[model samples]
Target: MTRIIAAVATAALLLTSTSAFAQAAFPTRPNTLQGQAACAGYTVDNYKERFAANSGGPDVQLHSLCAGAYNYYWMYLNAIRKGFSESDCNVTYDAFDKAARVVTNFWAETH
Candidate 1:
């Protein structure tokens, strides 16, 4: 009985700790910006900066940070649309969208 109780407790703890948080996909509404096309000026740079900062300023990325910024921003915006208050939107979407647009514009102009 004692061994069984311990095993059950251990399993319960594992189940609780391993519970995954729901990370929903971004919506396809007009509100969501994709790549450097819709966003041209500020989206890329700002996100790059943020990613670098998060990485302790080494400024390395295995994948495109711009893409991550766009996705993260879109996801948060999705949260707001799902029921977050207008004031609680946290403005992350705007930041990412701005960077994406800037980057897009720069590439378009240069190329």
Candidate 2:
């Protein structure tokens, strides 16, 4: 009976630890600006492919916003890797954030 109890306790401990580790592995939000931009782009692309196929994908406004966000994300990332000043990268980062926000909002509204 004691052995069975010990085994059950061990199993319970393992289950609890596994759940905690899994939760830590997945964050609720993107931790990096580039990650956020990619998420925005993915959402926008999914929307265009799934919902706007008949209408020829996203409208001009959304396409412009999403494309600009994706483009700026890569540019900003490259600039940072190349040792650009934070001040210089700020403008690009803001542009990407703004466009990403618009894309996210549009996606939320449509779905």
- The lDDT leader among the candidates is 2
RMSD versus native structure for model 2: 19.0
TM-score of each: 0.37, 0.46
Per-residue lDDT of candidate 1, residues 1-111 (tens digit)? 344334334433433444334533344334334443423332423655545455553323322444454654654455444544333333444444554455455546645
**Model 1: which ten-residue window has the lowest total lDDT?**
36-45
Give the root-mean-square deviation of each candidate in angstroms.
15.3, 19.0
Q: Write the per-residue lDDT of candidate 2 for residues 1-111, one digit (tens) a residue.
A: 344334334433443443221112221222142344334434423534523342455465555545545655555454454444454444455555665676677756664
Highest-TM-score candidate: 2
Show model 2 residue runs off by greater than 4 Å.
1-55, 58-63
For each candidate, the alpha-carbon lDDT, in order, equals 0.44, 0.46
